[model samples]
Target chain A: MLTCKDFLSELSDYLDDSVDSEIKAKLEEHIKACPNCWVVCDTTRKTIQVYKGQTECSIPLDIHARLMAAIEKKCAERGK
Target chain B: MSAPGSEAIVSEESGDLALARTGDAQAFANLIQRYEGKIFRLAQHITQNREDAEDVLQETFLKAYTHLDQFQGNSKFYTWIVRIAVNQALMKLRKRKTDRTVSMDEGIDTGEDIVAREIATWDPSPEEQYGREELAEILDSAVQSLAPAYRTVFVLRDIEDLSTEETAAALDLSIPAVKSRLLRARLQLREKLTKFFKHKGDDAFAYM
Candidate 1:
């Protein structure tokens, strides 16, 4: 029986699916029996999801232009 | 959880990479186009400043272009550029004197009694509760509140979806250290978001 502490300690590996099946079964058993651990797991998963769902911030046009100009200048210098 | 637009880039990368290495400016520009937004977002998240992020973004691409030959193609071009961008971002962070060094061996408290306090279930779609700009602001501030050490790990591993091995290599931390920091980062971010996401009665509260 994995304690909540054990589950917490293995949380990252568990979520990443890096934990072996034996430990995974124990952690899953712990979460099933523990509401707190379940909530923590569920919420933490959601936290990653929310951040992942964010759209990439578009580069500002001026910044994009500058990057292009810099790249072109570097290309020209390398050409020379 | 590859970043959006990354799949297309990966499929097209071999050709672009070959041409870019040959100093085809257009090929390099195509590569840049594929990754600029993601790199900028990553830079902004790491440096926590627009100006710094802009500089990191430009420097990352320029450095990539200059050192194009150095990329051994062992890793995805995205991963290669990410390594450069992360370095650029961290350099910018250190330049601002806001960087904190966390020991790889430092222990994070995951004691038995350390279960999360706010266990209230969140709205089914907490993200949809806010407007796009508002959600972005909320997320930015939440992530910004994290220490740079934890924030960087989280951004790279979670948001950027870098593999654990990749993240460890990029941050120069031991695999265990990366795992420790990532765990702490995820839990802390979860706690921080709980305040905004926790379900409320009748009023149907939304994240502020």
Candidate 2:
């Protein structure tokens, strides 16, 4: 029987789908039988999902202008 | 100006990349326009500051442009730029000399600390319950609470969608080290988020 500690150790690999079949099956069996582990697994998965869903912050206009000016200066220097 | 989320630039990236390598300023600017938003976001997440992120964004592209010939094309241009951005961000972090920075080599034990303290299941679609800006604030605060070592790994591996091998290479960590840090980061963030997302009637302080 996989203990909660054991399941915790493998949780990341399990979520990543990188665990071998035997360990994966054991993890699945453990989660099915253990609500706590299941919640941990499910919530952890959702945590990743939430972060991944975040849209990239757009560069502020002032910063964008500064970046362009810097690039233009550098290009001119290289040209010279 | 290109729209903020213009992924259409991807198909044209290779052509711009070729021209940019040959010192075409407009082509390089196009490349910057496509990736600046994402690179700025990446810098913000790692450095946890807007000023540092802006500097990193500028420095990363400037360095990339200067070293354009050194880019061997073994990786996607985005990935190559990401490496530069990450390094620039880390340099900023180090310069601040804050206590939050921990050596990535410090060994983390996956023992009792790994146990899930908040076992309550979350509301389905908990993120949907909050406004997008609120959710972003919550997520950012949660990530910022983590130590820099874990935060960097999580940002690169999870948020940036870098492959484990690529992340390991970028951070100069062995594969197992990356896996361990990522695991710790995920569980820690999960536990932190549970405080916000768990069921209403459930014991918010519930322990397994």
Candidate 3:
């Protein structure tokens, strides 16, 4: 069974996909038996899912166009 | 100006930096076009304001262009670009100290209180009220609330998906500083969410 310490310690890596397959398997097996760990996993998963979704802000087309122009202008100036 | 995946353009950018050093305008433009989004996003995440972000993006590209000749081929181009963007964002943030003081022992204010109010007003059905998207938005706001000192590390490591060493290199902070700040940021976010759940009761995560 995975204790709270084990589950919490590996929680971030599990979310980040940095944990090894062997440890992940152990975690999955433990979550199957431990409701507490399962809740931790569920909450943490929700947390990461929420983080990634909200962090995505579009790069405005106008801004993109302006930045490209600036870069082009810089390049042109350097060319001279 | 060229097709995004134009083979010719791709090859041009992938060609020697010596070409870029020798004033290859198209090559430099290609490099900037390729990296502008990521650079803008990094700045936006760090500064949490589009104006500041735009400034950071401009500064980053200008610095990169001026120092293009100094770049060794060891690190990835985007990595170097991000380093410049992060620096610009941090510098801008430091300059804006009068904007919002990260008060120690800061009491809950309108921003968080409003968030809590909305969470409290959520529908009885957790699935309906607290969907994945809602949760994510709340988490992002929590991250945005963190002081610049903490927010930069959290975004660079978790949000931007940079490795510890890469984050350290970008911020010019020690690895231990990055690790410690990242951990503290995550803990603060978790605590904030935990309180949200505790206050909101069943509507917070009854679906799970």
Candidate 4:
């Protein structure tokens, strides 16, 4: 029987699909029986999903323009 | 089939890389335009300050331009530059040296029975929460609360959507190490949000 500690230890690798099948079966079994472990696993997975759903932002325009100017100057200096 | 013009862009980028290696500053600048947004965003997230991120942006491309020979085309150009930007941002953080050095083993000692905090499950779902301005702020702060080690891996793996192998390559860690850090980061962020929602009572549970 995989204890909660063991299940938690392998949760990352399990969710990531890096664990072997035999151990994976054991983890699934344990989480099925363990509500706390299930909460840990489910909430962690949901958290990742939520974080991924956040909007993608960019650097400000003036900052980007300044970056271009700065890199251009450095490239120009290298040209000299 | 290939998204209309994706093939052309790839081939064009390859040509640009070739030209860039041969001292074509214009070609290099084109490459910069292609990836500046991604690299800049990565820097901004890692450094968590606009000015520091801007400096990292400047330094990353400057180093890339000067070290074009170092690139061997084995990895995607975006990945290559992202690795550089990560290093640059990490270097800046190191100079500050205040709280940048979060031990990778910190808070990972949950080897006993797990305790489930009274975490309110989201109502409409996290995808729906995307449009809520306050949730966005909370999300950002939740990520910001993580130590740098976990934060960088989370951004690279989850936000940037890099594969585990790619993230391992970028951070120069074993794939297992990447997996562990990512897991811890997710758990910590979840606990933080759970507490936030539990206390607020009405934000995450409004639909319930």
Clashes of each: 0, 0, 1, 0
Q: Please give, for residues B132-187, the per-residue lDDT of candidate 1 as tens digits.
A: 88988888999988767788889989888889989887778888878888888888
TM-score of chain A of each: 0.87, 0.89, 0.64, 0.92
Interface RMSD of each: 1.6, 1.1, 6.4, 2.4
What is candidate 2's lDDT per residue for A1-80, written digit by digit as tens? 99999999999999999999999999999999999998999999999999988866688899999999999999889899
Q: Please, what is the TM-score per model? A: 0.88, 0.91, 0.70, 0.83
For candidate 2, the C-alpha RMSD (Å) to the true structure equals: 3.7
What order do candidates take by TM-score, descending? 2, 1, 4, 3
TM-score result, candidate 1: 0.88
Per-residue lDDT over B2-105 for candidate 4, one digit per residue giving the tens place of the 0 to 100 score: 35897898899999999999988789889988878778777877778878888999999988888889997998777888889999998887778676364434
Model 4 ranges off by over 4 Å: B1-10, B97-120, B127-131, B197-208
Q: What tens-digit string does per-residue lDDT give for candidate 2 at B52-84?
A: 898999999999999999988887788888889
Candidate 2 runs further than 4 Å off: B1-11, B100-102, B106-112, B204-208
Best by lDDT: 2
Model 1 lDDT, residue A56, Cα: 71
Stretches of candidate 1 off by over 4 Å are B1-11, B98-115, B201-208
Clashing pairs in 1: none
lDDT of 3 by residue, A1-80 (tens): 66656666566667667789999988888878877566555654554444555545557998888887787787678668
Return the DockQ of model 4: 0.52
Sorted into a CAPRI-style docking class, model 4 comes out as medium
